[model samples]
Target: MNMSPKSFLFLFLFLFSLAFTYGQEGLPRLRISENQRFMITEDCEPFFWMADTAWELFHRCDREEAAFYLKKRAEQGFNVVQAVALAEIDGLQSPNPYGETPLIGLDPRQPNPAYFSHVDKVVEMAAAEGIYIALLPTWGDKVFTHSWGKGPEVFTEENARSFGKWIGNRYKDQSNIIWVIGGDRNPREGTSDVAIWRALAAGIVEGTGGQDKALMTFHPQPAGPGGSSNWFHNDEWLDFNMHQTGHCANQPTYQKISYDYNLQPVKPTLDGEPLYEDHPNCFNAKELGYSLPEDIRRIMYWNVFAGAFGQTYGCHDVWQMYTTDREGINGPLRPWKVALDLPMANQMKHLKNLMLSRPFLTRIPAPEMIPANQEDNTDFVIATRDSEGSYAMVYFPTGQSKAVNCKPLNSRLLKVTWYDPRTGNQIDAGIISKAPSNTFVPPSSGGKGHDWVLILDAV
Candidate 1:
C-alpha cells in the first residue's frame, strides 16, 4: 500500500486515539432500557438505531476500502452497520481480499487467523468511528443452504455452537459490537435448525461472559407478521426483534411492527432490511421497476411511527459491494462507491433527527390521531406521539390533507410545524387549539416524492 507521509500520520493518530478511547472505556455500550421498548446508551440516553446494510463489507472490501465506507456512513449519521463474517457469496471457500478464507480446511473449529485479523481490524476501525458492528457470525446458507445462497452447509449443531463461542469470545471486549444472528433465513420446524440457532445463542452468551454482556437479535428473511419474534420472542437471549420488509415497495410494514409491539413479553422491534435504494421492486424489474427514494422513506417513517425502536437502510449495490468489474444483482444503477451518495442515503438522517428532536423515548404509535381506514390507501398518513401526550409527529406519504384527532394529544393548544423529509428543513404550521378534531394539510400534495412530516409540540 503506497501512501504519502501525511496519510501515514493520519492513520497513526487515528489508531492512537481509538486505542486510548477504548482502552480506558470503549464506545458507549448499549443496553435494553428498563421499559424494554428501546435501547439506551451506557449513560442511559435513548439510542436511535440509524443503521446501513453492508453485508459484504468484511467479505469484499480491503482495509482502505473498508475505511472509506465507514467514514462515509459515519458522516451520514449511521451508528450501526450490519455486516457478515462467514459471508453469503461463497464465503467459506472463496478467499477475502487478503487471500485468506475464514475457516481452515472447511472446519468450523479451525478458524483462519489471517482472515479474522482482517475482520478484527475492520471492527476496530468501525469502533474508532463510533459505529457499532451488528456482526453476523455466518450467513444462514452456511446452516441450511437455501435456494439462492451458494452455501456448502458446513455447520452442524455442535460446530455451530463452537464457532459461535469462538467468534463471540474474540469480540467480547469490543464495546461497539452487537451480535446479530441468523442472516436472512428463518428456522423451519421439525428440523434441527431451531436447535442449532438456539445453541449458537447459548454459546454466545456463555462466551461473551453472560446474557447481560451482549445485546443480541436475529435477522430473518421477510416473514409474515412478527418476523424474528415469531421464532425467538420467548428466547431469553433475544434483546430485540428484527424484520426484513424485503425488496418491495408500498408495503404496510407498520402493521407488522404493530404486531410485534403488542406481543406479550415485549421486545423492541425494527425493520433490519427494507427495500433497498435501486433494488428491483419485488424482484421484478420489468413490471414493477426499481425502488425509488420515496418508496424507502415511507417504510422508514411507517416503522418509526408504528412503534419501532429504529430501523436500517440498505442499497442493493452497496450490500453486494458491486462494481463495474463485478456482476450486478438485479440491475444495479451504479457502482457501490457512487451508490454511497444516492439521494435517499443522505435523507435518512432527517427521520433520526425528527425522532430525537422531541421527547422520543416515551413515544408510542398514535393511530387514533389519524382518521380511520387511512391505511387502506397507499398514500396514507401515520402518527406517533409521546406517551405523556407532550408532542406528536405524523407522516404524510403524499402530503395529503387529513383531519387529525389532536384531542388525543392533550387538552391544550399545540404548536405545529412541517418537516421536510427530503431536505431536513422545518416550516412552522402555526398554532392551533386542542379540539375534537383538526384538519392539517401540507404545502404540496400530488403524487410520489411529495412526502411531509407534521411536528406537533404542546405550547
Candidate 2:
C-alpha cells in the first residue's frame, strides 16, 4: 500500500483532531435557562446546595487525595465544594508540601501547565461524583498575604482581566466548575476595584467556551454582603448573589442581611461563606470552636427559611489547615474525611429533601410571610408555603418556647404537625380550630437546641 505524502499528512491531521475532541470527554458544559434558572442537567435537581469548604485542595495534598475527599463529600450529600486556586498559606508556590510536585513554576508570575493538570484531575473527579467545584482563582491575596502563597501584583485591573481570561480558557468546558472571583479582600474602599472586578468577569465569560457558561459570583470578606453593592453585584456577568455573614457566628445580623438580599431584584442568592469551624459565636461572644452538628443545622435551616437559595458550610480544619500533617498552621486541622462523616451532613440531606418535597417551600418570601418582632428580638420566625396552598413550613430559632401567630393563613381545615429535624421524628400532630389566627407553641427542648418545624397541611 504505497500512500502519497499528501495522503499521509491528511491522515495525521484527521487523527489529531479526533484525539483532541475525545480528550475533552466528561467535561461539563452547563446551560442556564432564559429566565435565569439553573438548567437541570442529567437529572440534577435544584435541591438546596449543601456545601463545604475545601480551601486546601491544591495546597495541602495531591490529586489522589483531592479525589478521595471530593467523593466522600458527595456520599455525604454535599453537592458543592469551595476552593481557592492560590491559597493563603506559604510554601504552595513551588515544590509543594508533599515534596514531589511543585505548586507553580519557578517564575510564580507565569502559568504552569503541570499545576493546572492537577487541578483538572480534581475537577474531573468532582464531576464524576455529581459534585460541583466553586473555583476561586485567588484568596484575598490582593489585600493581605499570610503563610499561604503570596499574590502576584496581578491584583491590578490589567492583570486581573488577563488572569480571568487564562482561568476561563483552562476550565472552559468543565460543567461542574462554578466561577467564584473574590477572596476575603474587598477593592480599596473608594477605589475602582469595581472596574477591575468587572474586567476580570468579562474575561472569564469570554474564555469559558460558549459550551457552558459557568455561574458567576463573588466571595466577599466575612461580615461583608456579597453582590454588586460591594464589588460586582449588578455586573451583567454575575448569575447569582453570595454573602459572607462574618467568620464569627452573628446569627441575628446574618439573618437581617439575608432577609434584605432575598428581596433583591437580580438572580437567585445564597450565603456562600458563613462562620467557619470552631469560630466564635458572635451572638454569645463565646468561642464555640468548630461548628457543631446543631450549629450547622441551625445555620442551614435558618438561611433556607429566610429565603436563601443555598448555604455554604465551613470547618476550621478544612478552611485553614493546608497540609495533611496539620503542622505550622495556627488553626485546627481535623481531617476533612472525618468532617464529612459528621452527623450534620446526614441532617442536611434529610432536611433539604423534606423541604424540596413540598412545592410551597420554594414560592414564599421571607419578609411578607415570616415575622420577626423587634420588641422581642428572640421572637424571630421564618415561614414558607407550597404553591398549591396545601402545606407550609415554619422555623423558630429562639431556644425558648414562643407563640407564632399566623393571621394571613386562612384554611377551614388545618392540621398541625411538629417534626424533629435531627431525628426526622414526627413529634406530634393534631387538628386546629379555624380561628382568625393561630398560635404555634414549638417544642422548646428536644434532640437539638433549635425550635421545631411546624408543618401545616390543609385537610
| Model 1 lDDT on a 0 to 1 scale | 0.91
Return the TM-score for each candidate structure: 0.95, 0.81
* Model 2 lowest lDDT segment of ten: 100-109
List per-prediction Cα lDDT, in the order shown: 0.91, 0.64
lDDT of 2 by residue, 253-320 (tens): 44544544544454666777776655445423244544556655666676766666667877666665
1-459 per-residue lDDT for model 1 (tens digits) = 999999999999999998787655668899998889999998999999999999999999999999999999999999999999999888899899989999999988889999999999999989888899999999999889978888888888898889889988999999999999899999998889988888888888888999998799999999987899989999999999999989889788988999999998989999999999989999999999999999899989989999998889999999999999987767888899999999888999998998998886799899888766754456879999998888999999997888888876764889989999999998987888887778888979987789999988888
What C-alpha lDDT, on a 0 to 100 scale, does residue 423 get in candidate 2?
Answer: 74
Which residue runs does candidate 2 get wrong by more than 4 Å? Answer: 1-44, 91-94, 97-109, 142-149, 190-192, 210-212, 224-228, 253-264, 280-292, 321-324, 328-330, 366-379, 399-401, 405-410, 444-448
lDDT of 2 at 231: 54
Candidate 1, residue 73: Cα displacement in angstroms equals 0.5
Residue 29: error of model 2 in Å?
Answer: 5.6
Q: Candidate 1 — worst ten consecutive residues by lDDT sum? A: 371-380
